[model samples]
Target: MGTLLSGRARAHPRELARFVRLFTVVRREIEYALRPTGDLLHRLALETEFSDFAFLQTVDTRFRQGEPLSDAWDAAVLALQTEKLLKTEEIALIQAFCSAFGSTDPAGQSANCAYFIDRLSELQKGAAEAAGKKSRLYLALGVLGGVFAVLILL
Candidate 1:
């Protein structure tokens, strides 16, 4: 009986649509967050809190048009520090960027990344839990209706 009801519940069009929408939103957000070479330099300049890097200044020059800062400084710091062959001045610039924009040094960026990732994971988990609950509710409703029909016939 449970298996039969589960099959019927899975066939519901509305539940399928909701699942698809949830998946699409999660995919888009994750892709945006993980993209390589996102507009970090542009963001740093506009935010103006961490525009000390000379390379960032050059990157700023290419953008003749107005653009909003979307990338966080913490992300940029992590990217720079991850590079193995960076010069002392380059490292210094990364530190400066972190200082201007981030709450802490390189460690702060790591912590921030961890925090954000954890939040994303939590959101995904919550969505899955909600979907499971909805599925269970639908299954229960179908099963109860079936039982009620049998009782009425008897």
Candidate 2:
């Protein structure tokens, strides 16, 4: 059970790392290139190597279908949540980001992305540490269990 939880915990950091990278890209595109979000999303959908790249495509499609950008983003995040890809706190953070995104000037947009990137990075680090601790704890428990079984058998 601990091993299972450790594995699940490991995935949290990986997903957060992907989001950190994604938002970093957003910040760069908005701050340096001054590109509109639609183009950026389309490009990211095509170019991102992450397993969750489909969410970007989904957001792009939803946005093109006359939905608000935030709504489209929410739909995509909902998909992630449905897949158990994000925890509750992560989802809330993403929802907050969705609300703030594209609701301001280019500078503010860039700043928002940057801020989220930092936040996601911090979460990723914490998740990684948790996973490591869980892994070690589980390994120790498993060894102890095996020793107990061996003694009982003897």
Instruction: Pick out the ten consecutive residues of candidate 1 with the lowest summed lDDT.
Output: 14-23
Global local distance difference test of model 2: 0.81
lDDT of 1 by residue, 102-125 (tens): 334434444544544444344445
Residue-level error in angstroms, candidate 1, position 44: 19
lDDT of 2 by residue, 15-100 (tens): 88878888888888888787777777777777847435666778888988989888899898889889786778887787788787
Q: Give the Cα error of residue 99 in candidate 1, in Å.
A: 14
| Span of 10 residues, lowest total lDDT, candidate 2 | 46-55
List where candidate 2 sits over 4 angstroms from the true fold: 1-4, 51-54, 143-154
What overall lDDT goes with each candidate model? 0.44, 0.81
Cα TM-score per model: 0.29, 0.81
On TM-score, the leading prediction is 2
